[model samples]
Target: MDENGFWAMIEAAWGVAGGKAKPRQRLSEGKLSEGRAYALQEVLEEEVVPALLERLDALSADELLEFDRILERKLYDIDRADIQERTDGSDDGFLYCRGFIVGMGRAYYEAVRANPDRAITDAECEQMCYLSWHLYHDKFGEMTPSGISRETCSNPAGWPPDSKPDAAPDAAG
Candidate 1:
């Protein structure tokens, strides 16, 4: 799927998992506690995940890979120290936090991307990161790595080469 289609699925999932009052409203009002985060995750897992799986099930193998790549890019693009610090998690936890941001849909994702301070510290959506992998394994009996790492600080462009202590200096100097 294309970027728009990818985001549309996310948006739809968010709508389903939102329940009556809407999760974003709670997010905006700063009501996201650890308990609330877990509650939201539960709803997403129960309702949205099966829906997402059904949608992914219909895609051709190529489209599924494309969707995974787009998800990797989205997660990669948000892999900044500023965002991670705000979210406050372990390496894997940070990855899930980023997935939570993407699962919130395009508007919230863009908001957090533009301003890391907008991140919610308590929320996570780990399942969103591995949907394509799960489907690919089920369908083909094999899973190819996406070549991009979804872990925090893994994107060179987002993290910057100079920011890494082990980075090599310019050879021409």
Candidate 2:
């Protein structure tokens, strides 16, 4: 799917699951306390994911692949040490946390992408990491692999070459 189409579905899912209040607002306004964030995470998994999957279910195989690519790229792009540290997860957990950010739709994703401090610690949307996989399997009874890896520290630009995920960025004057 194209970017607009992809984000429209994400927005729809968030609206359905989280009401009219945008996640970016909640995060920026400090409305999502730990308890509220956890509650939102549960709603995302139980409600938003299914809503998104239902929308994705209508796409052709090629569209599904495109969706997978976009989602992978979004997750990969945010796999930065600065962002991951704020989110308080590592490895698969960090990957899922990125998924949660993406699931909040384009505005929220951009906000968090531009500011690592916007990340919500302990809030995760794990099901989002497997969205395309589940849909592809349910539709065609097989797995569909994409060109990118959504794992933490997978993006070269986000991490120093040959450095561990938690390593600090280079110092320069």
Candidate 3:
């Protein structure tokens, strides 16, 4: 796939793996609200990781390495502590969780690629993906019930929060 297509696939895969929300309920007198934490936990543990590993097995050694590099870049690009802080705020928590998946994705991809003679299957991939996702959830906790609010969050900020137009170099004499 082309670079754009590849990243798109990654984004789409993440979306599918992220799953959908359930119906919301009203907060009544003295009743506490519960989120979909349990369901999300189960899905992550049961599905996503395995799918990823299966995909990895289908690739050639070189292709697997390429996938590993992509995942590694993603992991390195993320700010771990910031992700943890945002876990309470938005889908940044899911983005953080993606980091762990990326790590396992890379490792398993490399492992299968390095040993091409070994057989790997879709079921195994799904298991790995599920395991990775669950591990992330367990370590990080459920993503905020509000889920990730991508609408307000910037993937990359335009400038440092403290910076202003005054910081720019003068263009006019």
Candidate 4:
């Protein structure tokens, strides 16, 4: 739930990715190692490899919204100048971070659906659905009820099915 937790997860994922044991460090105790800062340059296309699995298991399933909030900040509040400086304007970091946040929401929905014992509030589910659609549309260049249906259904078996259409919708509505 803090930057140390975030950096630790980042370090662990990279360590695993490179075929080494995850570097488990107490990031809360001090600054992140400058060593891993170098790897950020090598991240494919500069995309921040989101530590999704790390976050999922680190916190209880019911606290997914907290995860969502973290992603929200990372995606929305990311300093453009900082990312540009870090990755030389590749845009990979920006795209990846945004997608990663949305991805976490999607993962949470699927994970919770598969195991309902750690259920989120209905409002949280709806927020996840909205966030999913918003991000999907942002990346995919189109938004439709069908797109939302794929993700935000009571059950995955036959979701977003022929539900009643809203009276009207506008581009910004």
Candidate 5:
């Protein structure tokens, strides 16, 4: 997907999922409210990240690094302390939660920055994607149930003896 398509997916998901920094116990709005975590599974990776990776892979090494900078420093910049303070109730859990998914990308971006020529592996990409599951959800607290296990979930996208994901194309290989 192109950047527009990718961003549109996010907009649509947020629209379906209510676009707020926080999510409701169940999505009272949107056609997809019926499925639990439907937005999470569908909107995030099945749709967005792959498209984003496509775009990321097509860029020059300098462009890739710049994209990462803009994403972390500007787009996904959430103050951890701010989220922590809002932990008083479920209504606010999403505020803290969204960061998890963003972090996955951020983690990979940081890795790439460390070595611009090293590609992030497909496996590492998946591990980075899974970071969303660990980020938020106390507020949902059984309200919107899911099968994801924080402990069992592994982000081995960049793993083993040499710890980094495969390159995006311009990075290497």
Candidate 6:
């Protein structure tokens, strides 16, 4: 698909997976504003993926492999879980799905940052986001706000805690 088509698909998939709305209705009802869509595309292409890659670049090959393994584990969990099995059903599932999408976006960013010459394209990011959303939604029914919060908290250093040690420890001690 062309770039615009690809992004549209990403937005639609996110809407559906996150329980935002069906694409047709969202388009007709003016829910999926063009500006918002464009902004999301920009963030994915220019900012998010680049940032992620930068973070990954600082890691050694073994670290990258470990991060990949973590992502794989999360993906597996998404595939096996059934959203409808939960009491909250699809609504809660969607929230969780959105969280996963955000996480995947961060991952793409890391990957692109790690290898600037091999930066991920907008199309690739969109496709990955779509897939991640569906995987989480299908497994979790409706996603919870708590899930989103937890995802946000996954990187505590991003926010930084209150205190730190003032001096270096003696090696001999």
Q: What are the models' TM-scores?
A: 0.78, 0.84, 0.37, 0.31, 0.33, 0.30
Native-vs-model 6 lDDT?
0.34
Off by over 4 Å in 5: 1-38, 85-96, 99-173
Provide the overall lDDT of each model, using Cα atoms, as 2-decimal numbers.
0.73, 0.77, 0.34, 0.32, 0.32, 0.34
Worst 10 residues of 2 by lDDT: 164-173
Highest TM-score model number: 2
Tens digits of lDDT, candidate 1, 1-173: 89999987766665666542456556544455657656766676677777777788888988888888899889989987678778855777788888888876676688788878778885788888888878877897775676777776677666554442233222234
Q: Give the per-residue lDDT of model 5 (tens digit) for 1-173.
A: 33443334334444544444343212222222324333453454455555444444555544444333333231233312222222112212322233333323333223323432221111112323232222222212222323221221122222232422222111123
Model 4 lDDT per residue over 31-112, tens place: 3343442332234112223333534444543243344444444444322232223222223332343332233233322332
Give the alpha carbon lDDT tens digit for every residue of 83-136 in model 6. 212211233332343323334333332332333222212212332323323344
For candidate 3, give the lDDT: 0.34
- Give the deviation of candidate 5 from the true structure as CA RMSD: 17.4
Task: Name the TM-score of candidate 2.
Answer: 0.84
lDDT of 5 at 52: 49
TM-score of 4: 0.31
Find the candidate with the highest lDDT and give its number: 2
What is the Cα-based TM-score of model 5?
0.33
Clashing pairs in 2: none
Better of 2 and 5 by TM-score: 2
lDDT of 3 by residue, 44-63 (tens): 44554444554555555445
Task: Quote the positional error of residue 106 for candidate 6 in Å.
Answer: 9.3
